[model samples]
Target: MNNHFITLGNLGLCVAASLNAQRLFKDHRAPAAGIFLVVCSAALSVLPATISLDWSSQPAALCADLQWAAEVLSPAMVSFGFLWLSDDHFTAYTLLTGSALLSMLTGWLSRDGLSVMSRCMAMSSLSCSLTVCLFAGNPLGILGSVLLSAPALVGLSGTSPLVSPEAAGGLLKLGLIGAMTVGCWAIRWALEIYVQDLKGWDKSNNILT
Candidate 1:
């Protein structure tokens, strides 16, 4: 039971990594290949979990039929992940775009020690931003997303990285993360305030039980 949750979380991370890769680089090839791998791995990992979900019942029936359905549907679900990763570009769009972005901004990283710290903070923000996007409405995910905001605020105040566009783009990424923090809080608040009353609502405590 615990393994299922862990595997599901792994699937989310892989899918999110694939999506973030495409977002960062705009390259379809790496993300497409990654999606294929992720889908295969996800099924190999999650099929067993689905069977375990049946244990919530009196006597779990054999999951042969469900497993077969999962097999048939897994390819399409994997394709959705692929599409989510690609953003629909045919060529190496993400890679090219991300490369261009980094190239256009490389000269501006601060040589100073204080500025280096700022850069580190910005990097942390970027990581948290993606975590927020990956987790969507989850409170823990939203907390990760909130962490991004602090770094963004720090980066904006501490760095002067505008001589080149590449560096500027990096700074912009940090700023985007700050923006996402607000979005994450909004979603979290919405879920807490309005969604809890829904009929099917229950805490995640039972997910692993």
Candidate 2:
């Protein structure tokens, strides 16, 4: 059952990656760097599953290290990538980058999987959602943002003595995958609406001229 959930989550990541790619290609104005990061993050997130399934012949230590590296890097990469896609300002990018780095360091130092990294992921997801809502002024975008942030928030707050850490981790992973998939689709929807509005404005201006 846990493996099934992981597989589903991986599928969600692939879907999110494809949606991001579609958005990137359809909108030439979209930054390639952000899309590339998102796609790379998605791919990296799935590395553990792939390694476990196909790299049985390889040294276990090597596979474990590779998977650990991917797990550590993926959340930060995806968070920053979404932030960049929503708001392309240098200050915002710098701030997010710094926060991500700090979170990574904190996670490494504490050796707690759920400490700094999960909080950072939640906050970054919220920031991305809020940015999209502000730019597009869409209610659906706001709702989607809440949904995207819900998993991380829940994971942070809902840990209990009754639930095993492994179970919690698995559920959190599933939730994060679903959130990412929803977030990508929501951002794409907002961008499409914003672009259509711009086109309408341009047509109106041309007529007035």
Best by lDDT: 2
RMSD (CA, Å), each prediction: 19.8, 5.8
How well is each residue in 81-112 modelled by candidate 2, as lDDT tens digits? 34444455563466456645654564355434
Superposition TM-score, candidate 2 onto the true structure: 0.57
Cα lDDT of candidate 2 equals 0.53
Query: For residues 98-134, could you state the per-residue lDDT of candidate 1 as single tens digits?
Result: 4334324435544354345434434443343344344
Q: Residue 145 CA error for candidate 1 (Å)?
A: 4.2
In candidate 2, clashing pairs total 0
What are the Cα lDDT values of the candidates? 0.36, 0.53
lDDT of 1: 0.36
* Regions of candidate 1 where Cα sits further than 4 Å from its true position: 1-111, 136-155, 163-209
Worst 10 residues of 1 by lDDT: 67-76
Each prediction's TM-score versus the true structure:
0.24, 0.57
* Candidate No. with top TM-score: 2
